[model samples]
Target: MTGIKMAAAVCVALFLIMPTIAIKNHDVTEELSDVPFISAADAAHMQEYVAFDTREKDAYQKEHVQDALSVPPAECSECLFDALDIYREMNILVYGADDAATADAVELLLKNGFERVWG
Candidate 1:
């Protein structure tokens, strides 16, 4: 009976933990891709879409993509979800000083359900 109880407890624990593990894995997978660099011309053309510069506020204030919104990497997701009211269908372009930061922003956007998320 004790062995059976142990097995049942283990099963319950796994059942509770599985979803969290899956969610974490999904989050990791979402952020694993490199963000593509968009050219100035292309960016110009897509001006209707929101362009986010995922850099520090100082760096963003210095200079960034023309007309791009300054959303620091740490606050990108919150800015998008809260301040911007960006719908999943909206074309959202995320960029940074380098690929890794851009990719991180993209992952966050994608995870948050932005369908047209691009970097």
Candidate 2:
């Protein structure tokens, strides 16, 4: 009777709260996924570093961080290591049109053993 009703109520409350918790967790993950890389400000502060803008040469030449270099993403697979050799022991920050593209370039740089890689 009364005890059975109380138990049912508790179960219903738990079920309702569970969905809210799950939704909040999902929202947090979505927000984090959208920001998969570091900020430009962090890249700017590095003492010894290279900023590689993976955008097209035209877009890169139009406007880029001071001292940044233009290295299109398509060409990165072949040239990143060679370029890094010129700045050995310096941090490398890769950036592009958006986070996804930047993240892809960062992954390639890391795989190729470019230490201190960032994006």
Candidate 3:
């Protein structure tokens, strides 16, 4: 039984590690040159901007930036677009639970012609 458990653990570990090993590392600086991702500090310095909290409502309710609007893109996209339409001309700053989530929201906004979208 111990040997079987050990073997199962090893297989699980290998399964998780394989994808990371197979993927190629990207140069973040080069990739971000044209991207609108900005540091939190830089975002703070900006005077006029509408910050969108892309996390779930529960997360937003727990804790979020002052005046940040909760618009979870994955949950209700129609509402997200509607909200975007209202603030189309404003500088939009998006943040989520993870980098991928934030990136996806920013990309969606950009595709929909929302300028000045930052992740």
Candidate 4:
């Protein structure tokens, strides 16, 4: 599967991310550019969370997780509270073009009072 597709599957599985993930037959675990998605059996759990595509605006317009809001790195600033305070206690899922970026975005969200954030 493609890297992004594999990542999406991971997103779904995490919420029961699927099994072993590989991109174009390459095991990308060590070289992954994005956060590693985990596993959870309850898909319903996602209902209590919000998902954000933390890439640039153009990138997010081109592609993003279904139902996820587009919150570019710059947009993730303190202004988030204007709309996210009501959901501060909710779980969050942040994905970016790469792993490091995703981690940073997740951390930012957490610091801003998001209780839980998953890859």
Candidate 5:
């Protein structure tokens, strides 16, 4: 009877925890689902690279990659292209809240003939 009770308790605990695990996994999967992310270690190793923070001006001013350009996602594509025209030959790495921002910036850069763009 003791052994049976222990087994039943373990089973109940597993059942209770399984859904939480699944929910956490789903949330993790949704984050960065469409964006290409370079690991921090890998990013640190990039040679002659420029990092751009694509969040809002306030968020960027608060905290951003060291020496990163504050390129707000709300900027026009033409303006972005013009601002980054000089860096066309360099590696450009962008980061923001999500696809609507950072990923879109990456896409705009690529469309405007900026090579070596990433998020």
Candidate 6:
């Protein structure tokens, strides 16, 4: 009886929590869908774009797109906002070591009212 009750309680908790988790995850995906991914060639064709670098300081210093401003990672929200706030009106091209890193930076930029952002 005790084991059955425990199993039932666990099932009930998961049933309630799973939908909430799924909804939250889905919303995050939907929110990011609006931010487009531009190829390096496409970005180069643009007359002007603010290159936003989400790579580590060392990686950025070693090699990055010309004129890319090092904004580091999205974990530092305040730093990203402070560095990028002035360029809100400009088109931004974000690049990082991986897709996940770039997406996180792009998401942060979009949430902060940066309308023209690409990864």
Candidate with best lDDT: 3
Off by over 4 Å in 6: 1-34
Clashing pairs in 1: none
User: What residue runs in model 3 are displaced by over 4 Å at the alpha carbon?
Assistant: 1-34
RMSD of 3: 14.5
lDDT of each residue in 12-105, candidate 3, tens digit only: 4323322221112253444334456765445445556777878889988987665678888766476668766878898787777765666677
**What TM-score against the true fold does each predicted structure earn?**
0.59, 0.62, 0.67, 0.62, 0.64, 0.65
* Candidate 5 wrong stretches, greater than 4 Å: 1-36
Q: Rank the candidate models, highest TM-score first.
A: 3, 6, 5, 4, 2, 1
Q: Lowest summed lDDT over 10 consecutive residues: which window, candidate 6?
A: 15-24
Candidate 2 deviant stretches above 4 angstroms: 1-36, 77-80
**Positional deviation of residue 105's Cα in model 1 after best superposition, in angstroms:** 0.3
Strongest candidate by TM-score: 3
> Could you give candidate 4's per-residue lDDT for residues 92-115 as a string of tens digits?
766677555766776777667676
- Full-model lDDT for every candidate: 0.56, 0.56, 0.63, 0.58, 0.59, 0.62
Model 5 lDDT tens row, 21-49: 22113443454354454444344455567
Candidate 5 differs from the real structure by a C-alpha RMSD in angstroms, to one decimal, of 15.7
Per-residue lDDT of 55-100 in model 1, one digit per residue for the tens?
A: 8999878765555678786775565577766446666766666556
- Predicted structure 5, TM vs. truth: 0.64
Total backbone collisions for each predicted model? 0, 0, 0, 6, 0, 0
